[model samples]
Target chain A: MRRDRSIIKNEKSLRTYITPPADLYETPDAYILYIDLPGVTKENLNIKVVDNSLIVQGKFELSLPKDSDTMFSELAKGEYRREFVLAGDVDRNKIDAKLVNGVLILTLGKKEESKEIEIKIE
Target chain B: MTLVRWSPLRDLATEIFDLQREINKMFDRFFRGFEEEEEVRISTWSPRVDISETDDEYIVRAEIPGVSKDDVKVTIRDNVLTISGEKKQEKETKNENFHRIERVYGSFTRSFTLPGAVKVDKVEAKFKDGVLTIKLPKVEEAKTKEIEVKVG
Candidate 1:
């Protein structure tokens, strides 16, 4: 019986959450961050940047009608909250956020003073 | 969909996937409202709410599905209103293939700090259609009243 219980415990721990993949890339003008968040909606998401910290939050709603019963449940439902410390080069004022499909795209441009500019002489 | 040995459409598929993810995030944020990290939990989606004033009392509504009245716990502490509850999972399934499972379970705790004094003893909560509604009637002194205006 003890051996059987151990196997059940192992199986429960083996069931893990699939971490969504994200990518952060830099361009000449901006740093772009792409996050993959499947089975999510625009109505339950939030993004905020305070000083050097960037916080992203999202909730997945899973309510069914009154006479509904579940045959199976695989998708996990809860709030998604993640935070990141911003690099000094990121321009807090010029950051842009856009959501399409189930992914979140954030573009943080360089500070205004750091942009490359060419001098013109008449 | 057939895959060709050399197809530029592969890149198009990746772009479409990216766009879908972005749109999903936008919609999620619009409905979540403001939340603090302390509200974290394994499951249970608690929505942010705005409480309004009325002539008699204040109205508060919370979205808590799959939870019965007996599973919920309401308490008032230090002028903060707290609601905590659990939604137990249904009976186990023996054999079934699920394409999608999206309902949230487990427990959740949500608190709101009142701006004015509340008659805690008189507070009431009602659950209907997966929504939890609370009424916090104000005390006699806490009630808002219009005063006569005098020219300065």
Candidate 2:
């Protein structure tokens, strides 16, 4: 029921961009996002923030032997795309991204003024 | 209108019938080389795989992200190739407040029957970048041969 769009198709490339499964976690200092992108290398992954939206794109290469015929195919090869709208508290400049074991981990730090502050009473 | 009383035995029989139908549907999907999308979120999820056949060998590649190389197991028994593994969740995320969770975790197993005989001793499997590729060399008799005819 989330408002994010799932899949997008490129007209020129004729390649479909699937939305990879993701998990979002909120901590006191940052928001962490995990995206599963199997068979995608770090060089094939792209992440950028435009305005208040964070967009991620990845491509998976399927290498087959010469003169080979595919008998059964269930794995989707091509591209993966997903976009998330940033909240006001999220500091876009403090975002960190890393690829580990084919999973993309993104940490979006919270803004200075948005973090919880403890006040002492005299 | 006639009121019918609920019977426990009848209800049990209907439940068993539904279970049998579900199993049959699962087998049908397996033979068709397809899986339902909604099933990915279940506790036990199967990774997507691609099978290709060359002139000398059969290649199988499976997509299993976030799984360690040591957690995977590949075996060919009775001409059935099976790939089983576990995708463990990160322990650091346990304390964090989760907003949305769509990725699947836990153990998975996928099996496929080989169409031809292969050299089990020469099979090789490699895991890289969360994808496992297995190569099964075909036996001599199973390899395709080219024959030419000479006109008299």
Candidate 3:
């Protein structure tokens, strides 16, 4: 356990079994990443891309009483945070993000020159 | 002769308190209406467990899926069995996106007081496919045995 500035300098990956499955697909033009994120509203979600990295942040409101006795509670009350680094061939300006059914689907289009890669043996 | 004016602070506090109470009531109704409420997240998620008693030993099984074996810790001290663990989040791409997050994370601990005398020195624990099984063998005298009676 090592720390700097009272903050965890190195955070291990935060994996959750409840996270929606992600599907990656690539065509000649672009690549698509689909992730499921239920119980989240668009108003409470934020998506940002900075310096070749994409960040997704959203708070899950349990909306439960603090003192009330709960029969069962499965939905965790906290902000969901996830980040990903972009590849060199990714066209950041053309990236698109959409939230539907509590799932975040991101489409990263490839650069024009990289769309049709060529390999030749001299 | 001076006149004292009433402030709205008290009225505001009362209004806030009433709002809080109303919110609580609404949440109570919503929770009651939940059909498939399974496990609630408190400080940690502790699932219900079942224990079986046999002639040789006591078998305990706990339902804790998505939790790794390395995260679970089991110990017995003075006839008190304590199980504790923390489920660490998994690794993802630098820009991992999630749609629905429902899993519970954090440290969970459960303690059980042994009902019958048993051999603590030989307590064994095995974690397989998300289920933790513990076997506590009963001492020779603590085990129920059949006695033969020879009479005319």
iRMS value of model 2?
Answer: 2.1
Q: Could you say which candidate leads in DockQ?
A: 2
Better of 1 and 2 by DockQ: 2
Candidates 1 and 3 compared: the better one by DockQ is 3
Residue-wise lDDT of candidate 1 within B57-145, one digit each (tens)? 66665555446678878787877777788865442333332222344557887765665688988999876534566788888887668
What's the alpha carbon RMSD for model 1? 23.7
What candidate 2 gets wrong by more than 4 Å, as runs, is: A1-15, A119-122, B1-43, B91-96, B149-152
- The TM-score leader among the candidates is 2
RMSD of each: 23.7, 6.6, 18.6
lDDT of each: 0.63, 0.85, 0.63
Cα lDDT for residue B55, candidate 2? 96
> What class would a CAPRI assessor give candidate 1's docking?
incorrect
> DockQ for all models, in order?
0.01, 0.56, 0.03
Estimated TM-score per prediction? 0.40, 0.78, 0.40
DockQ of 3: 0.03
Residue A1, model 3: lDDT of 30
Higher-scoring candidate on TM-score, 2 or 3: 2
lDDT of 2 by residue, B92-127 (tens): 566758888899998998877787889999999998
Model 2, A13-68: lDDT tens digits are 36467889999999889999999998889899999997789999998998787899
